[model samples]
Target: MIITKAKPIEEILPFLEGKERIFLVGCNVCAAKMKTGGEPEVLALFDYLTGLDYNVIGWAVPTAACSVRSYESLVEKNEKLKEADCVLVMACGSGTSVIASILDLPVTGTNDTLSLGGQIGSSAINHLCSLCGDCNIGDYSGICPNACCPKSQINGPCGGSKNGMCEVSKTSECVWYIIEKRMKTVQTLPILNKIKPPKDHFV
Candidate 1:
């Protein structure tokens, strides 16, 4: 899933400075899960903007704000959108870009795209993939040092690691340590014998 966080109100306020008719768009998937751009959030923003004397024509919490089909569906049915001079998108940067591309009016986002992550039970795990063209996650039992490690240490941990924690940050568990533990658990310790080469950044 794509992780997202709300932008400060101060930043969003500037985008609405002179806009009168406003149409708000929210994401129902990732942003909804994160409580950033859910239906509740859209309604809250709608009321807040209405209280400020702005005419909020309409709002929609699309199934996925990133989909062109979603916005097309909205445009087909929501006549209120046609009256708006600008759109406020409560979703990730990708969603904002999609809206901007489809709409002729000015479009702005309320959320900042954080990272690609997944849910581990109730916990949200981030930095799972760096999106490097070259993937060698299979070698480390599905752990990618390029993304999990602050230093991007592929072969092993830096000498500064202590107590299974990264030297760069006391709060972070050393990725190499996690990789070693995972390798041992799967009886693939011999895989560690093979050295990994430097990452090809050009890819």
Candidate 2:
């Protein structure tokens, strides 16, 4: 799932200083589930802006805000978006880009889109994919350092690891330790012998 968090209202207010008519957009898939850009959050922003004495034209929470087709349909239906002075997108980075591409108005964001992550349950999640495009999961028995490690260490720990914890974060564990333990349990340590080459930055 794509992780996202709401930007502080204080930080967002600066963008609306001179603007009057505002159009709000939200995402219904990733941000909706994350509670950052869903309809409820959009409505809350609408009220907040109303309290601040801005004319809110309209708001739409697209089912998939990252889809060009979905966002186009929303703009076509609202029409207020065309008249508004600017648009505020309360979605992930991908979704925000989609809205900006399909609109002629000034576009702004209200959420910080985070990494692609894995969900352990309904609420708990952890970063799972860094989208490096190299995909070395086969080398480490499906574990990926790019996703779990702070330094994006490809080979092993930096020797700062102590008591199975990462050098940077006390709450986070050393990814190499997890990889080593998994390899030993499955007797797949031999796979690590085929070291990964340097990642191609061009890709």
The 0-to-1 C-alpha lDDT of every candidate, in the order given, reads 0.89, 0.86
lDDT of 1 by residue, 1-203 (tens): 77888998889989998898999999999889888999999999999989988889999888888986744677886788988999999998898998888889999999988777777876778888887888999999998899899898998999999999999988989999999999999998799899989989898
* Whole-model lDDT, model 2: 0.86
Steric clash pairs (candidate 2) = none
Off by over 4 Å in 1: none
Worst ten in a row by lDDT for model 2:
118-127
Error of 1 at 20 (Å): 1.1
Best prediction by lDDT: 1
The clash count for each model shown is 0, 0
Models, CA RMSD each: 1.8, 1.6
- What ranges in model 2 sit over 4 Å off? 70-72
Return model 2's CA RMSD, one decimal: 1.6
- Our tally of clashes for model 2 stands at 0
User: What's the alpha carbon RMSD for model 1?
Assistant: 1.8
